[model samples]
Target: MSGLRRKLLIITVLLAAVMELIDTTIVNVALSHMSGNLGATLEDTTWVITSYAIANVIIIPLTSFLTTKLGRRNYYIGSIILFVVCSFMCGSSTTIWTLVFFRFLQGLGGGALLSVSQAVIFELFPKEKQGVASAIFGIGVFIGPTIGPTMGGIITENYSWPLIFYINIPIGIMAATSCYFLLTEPVIKTKVQNVDWTGIALLAIGIGSLQTVLERGQTEDWFATGYITLLTVTAIIALTAFILWELHIEHPVVNLRVFKSKTLSVAAILTFITGIGMFTSIFLTPVIAQRLLGFTPTQTGLLLLPGAIIAILGLMVSGKLLQRGVSPLIIITAGFFCFIFFNWNMFRMDLDTSAYTITLNLIFRALGMAFLTVPLTMLAISSLAPKDIPQGASLNNMMRQLGGSFGISIVNTYSARRVASHRVDLISHITNNNPLTIDRINSYTAYFMLKGIAWDNARLKAMGMIDAAVVKQSTLLSYTDAYFMIGILFAVTLPLLLFVVGGPKITAPKVIVSDH
Candidate 1:
């Protein structure tokens, strides 16, 4: 490919990847509007998000095999078409379930966009420039989700909720068209082998069940619900069996053998931790801003923008350093410490915290992640043969996704339990005879009386208001506690960096062909 054509291809592939990722979080802020418009209860409306997640998790691990089977260029084009068509259908649906189904199809299509885009981008460049390729792809991976909610909020506010999905149609069409013309299929070919059907079934069952339990568990009050219990058991059994089967199977759907590579193993572990911190911080910050601090969706999204910019800078700087022979271990360690500092700062957040404070802390977090993410991608693929790079990348990506799911689930569960515990502690201080309690109640009563409430009614109203205030305070404290918990997790993981096997420093190779 010519220089201009290669650049255009890279731009096209990056756009497609970003489009896929943005869809993952874009619908989040618009869920309420969707529920109301579709005439579905909030709980049922949640399936719209859950369906996409389930499809994404399932399809992600299967991408390597699917690409081999379908041919990369054909598969890439097909996925874009599928995504665009589904987006249109998702927008036009008259009922909630129809939209959910379309979203699932969209997820199936979007799942390949990330993995294939990475592979295509890698193939575009030569061996030595792999670090630069990774840095470029890193932007889409990290920035896409951060930007999703912000862009979604802007679209929903200015237009309508359906426009969020509708907006993808034009972009998807252009990407698909460009991909068909620009993406060249590799000449190398492989024989068709029987796919491990059993492995696929078990994987889908295990991951799908596990994701369902995680996403729905909090809303259903965890183990208190019968369905959650059953799904939990099913997930455990399916996953255990899948692991065993993959170990023994002649041809597994996912190549579990890649984990045997020491570099890949260490990278996977670190990637999982990275996912935990990245996803949890993003997930928790929005809730803190919108729910606790009373920021609008647009305001909350804008607050995160600076961090994303810092992260891009971090990626570029780290990429250049790696190209010059910086040790992966050192860069990763620096990242871990930066991440810990960021979270530690977040632990001090209050209801009145300023946007600049949050933005600054997040920029540190982004820098930390930039140092970590690119080198780890290099570490994971460095030891593998060219044929195995895609498989390794797919597995690494899948683990990160699982880590995010695990982090979200654990954080939500812990936050809920903490709130209850704090609420109990707070309520204990509300003894009827306590002077402070009496004074607080009297002040509330006076406010109610001024609003024309009767004496007995005002007292009851004041007590209820006090109870609500106490609950809010307890929840706020619990959120802060969660931030501290994340900090500790990052701090503890720092020692493990010693074990990662850093490859010998070499100059990055030049680009011979454009994979994009």
Candidate 2:
């Protein structure tokens, strides 16, 4: 391929991948707008997010199979077209369920965007320059989720919610068109000997059930809800069977044998852990900014913008270092510590934190992620045969999505319980006999009285204010605890690097095709 065509294809796949990832969190800010506009309760509207996530995890592992069934060029373009059409359908839906169904379809298309794009990008460059490819793609991976909320906030606050989905239409078309003109099928194509229908069924049921449980568990009060409990059991049984059955099968839909590679195995686990920190931090920062500190959606988005921007350079630097044969372990270790530092800084944050401080703190996160993305991608697939790259990419991406889901669920439940515990502990000290408590209440009452309220009514208002303060303080404490725990989690996971056998050897992928 000529330099120009290669660049265009690179741009095309990266754009599609970024679009897919953006949708992952973009709908978050618009859920309320969607709920009110569609006349559905907030709970029902949440399926818009859940359905997309479910579709993503389910389809991700299937991308390798799908690519074999359909040629790479055909599969890539088809997925783009499918995504574009579903984006339109999602925007046009008048009902929440309708929107959710289309969102699921959109996710089905979007899943391939991430995994396939990674494979294609790696195929674009030679082994020695593979780090550059990783860096290029890393920019999208890091920036996509980072800017998602920022873009979502801008659109939700300034424009209609449907515009979020609609905006994808032009980008999707451009990507599809470019791929049609420039993308090529692999010179050596691999075929599935037979369709593993049973493996497919097990995979769908198991992964789908597990993803659903993770997405909805907190909202439904975890296993306390009957459906959540049932799904939890179903997920365990189905997943165990799926794993065993895949290993037993001749042609598995997902190649279970790839986990035999120690590098891939360790990389998968590390990716999941990274996903927890990455996605959870994104979740935590915006919540604290908006809920406690009273930042506008745009303002919260802006707070994250600088870190993401600075990380672009960090990604390039890390990729260059890898190209120079820096041990993947060293780079990843440095990344881990950067993120732990980020967690520590955020743990110290209070309601009085400035946007500048948050942005500076997030730069650590951005750099941490920048360091991880390239090495992890290189490490995961470094030992795999050329043909197995797609499968490895699929598994790696699926782990990330799952990790984010689990992280968000765990954090939500933890924060809720912590808030309750802290509130109770706080309330215990707010007795009438406590002089400081009495003085605080009296001060509130006098403030209300100055507004011309009756003494008894003012006193009642004062009590309500005190209760609100307790709730707010408890919420702050709970988030700080979350930050502390997350940091500890990162610290604990660092030792896993010792298990990585050797530095990654990024070889040129033979699976990518030359221009026709």
Candidate 3:
């Protein structure tokens, strides 16, 4: 390929991958709008997210098999087509369940965009230039979540929520057309002799059940609910059985055998842990903006723009350094430390934190992510044979996404419980017997009375104000605890980078095994 065509192909796949990842977090700010428009309760509306996530995790590990069946270029184009159609259908949905159903299908299509795009981009460059490929791809990887909320917030506030989905149609079409004409399929030497329907069934059931439990665990009250318990048990048993079956089967839905490659195995672990911090930061920031800082959705989105801009340079720098043959572990180690330091700084902030303060911290977060994105991705599949690259990419993407799901669930549960605990502790200091507490309530009552309120009404308002304060303090404390935990998480995972081994440079000649 000429330089112009290669650049265009890279740009095309980058957009495709970014679009898919943005959907992973875009609707977060629009949830309230969706609930009001669709006439669904907030709890039921959450399924819109859960359904899509469940579908995404279920289809991700199966991408290699699907690519084998359809051919790489065809599968890529087909996925884009499915995504575009489903995006339109999602916009047209009038009911909550209808939107949820369409979103699930959209996820099935969108899931392919992440892993397949990485593989395609790497293929565009030779082995030595793969770092540049990773650099270009990593920019989109971090930018997606950053821009997602910004775009979603802008769309939801100025227009209706449906515009969020409608916006993808044109981009998807262009990407699909360009890829069909530009990308080539790799030749495969061996084919799966038999299809493992049993393994596929077990994987679907297991992963689906696990995702549901993660998304709904807190709302369903975890093991306190029979259904939650049932899903949890089903996930455990099904996953175990699937693992054992895949180990012995002639053809597996996921290529678990790749785990035998130390490079791929450690890369998967690091990627999984990175996902927790990466997604959770995106999740928590918007909530903080709306709930604590009282920023509008658009304002919150704007606050993230600077970080996204800075991360681009960070990605390019890291990629260039790696291309010069710098150790992958060195870059990863630096990223882990930067992320931990940033998280700890966030833990120390008060409610009075300025937008600049938040944005500055986020810029560092993005930089940290840029460092991890390219190296971790390259480490996972760059070592594999051309035939195994697709499978490695698919598995790596699955682990990262699954890690995000697990991270969000855990932080959600921990924050909820911590808020309750903090509120209790705070209430203990608010008793009537305490002179300061009594004086504070009396002062609030006097302020209300100055507004011509009756004594009873003023006292009631005073109590309400105290309750609100308690809730606010508890919320801030919970956020603090969550950030602290994330810092510790990064620190604990840093040791794994020591054991990472990069695959040797590719020297084998190419073989064509495409169905085409």
Positional deviation of 340 in candidate 1, in angstroms?
1.6
* lDDT per residue as tens, model 1, 1-516: 888888889999999999988887787667667888999986677677668767877888888888888898999899999999999999999999999999999999998898889888888777767776877887788888778878877887678888989889999999988988899875455544898889899999998889889877888988999999999999999999999998897778888898888888888888889988987787778778777787777777777788888888787777777767777787888999998999888888777789889989988988888888888887878888788888899888877777766776678778888999999999999998799999999999999999999999999999999998898889888888888998899888887787774454523322223443
Model 2, 314-371: lDDT tens digits are 8877876766667778888999999999999988887788989999999999999988
Clashes of each: 4, 0, 3
**Candidate 3 residue pairs in clash (backbone atoms < 3 Å):** 187-512, 187-513, 188-513
lDDT of 3 by residue, 1-516 (tens): 777787788789989999999998888778778999999986678677667777777788888888777787888899999999999999999999999999999999998898788877777767656666666677777899778989989999999899999999999999999998888876453475677788889998998888778777887888999988999999999999999999987678787998888889988998988888888888778777777878788888777788889888777777667656677777888888878987888888778888889888988888888788888887887668888888888898888888887787788778888999999999999997999889999999999999999999999999999999899889988987898898899899887887774454322111211111
User: lDDT of all predictions, in order shown?
Assistant: 0.83, 0.85, 0.83
The predictions' CA RMSDs to the true structure, in order, are: 2.6, 2.9, 3.8
Judge candidate 3 at residue 302 and give its lDDT: 77
Instruction: Quote the positional error of residue 174 for candidate 2 in Å.
Output: 0.7
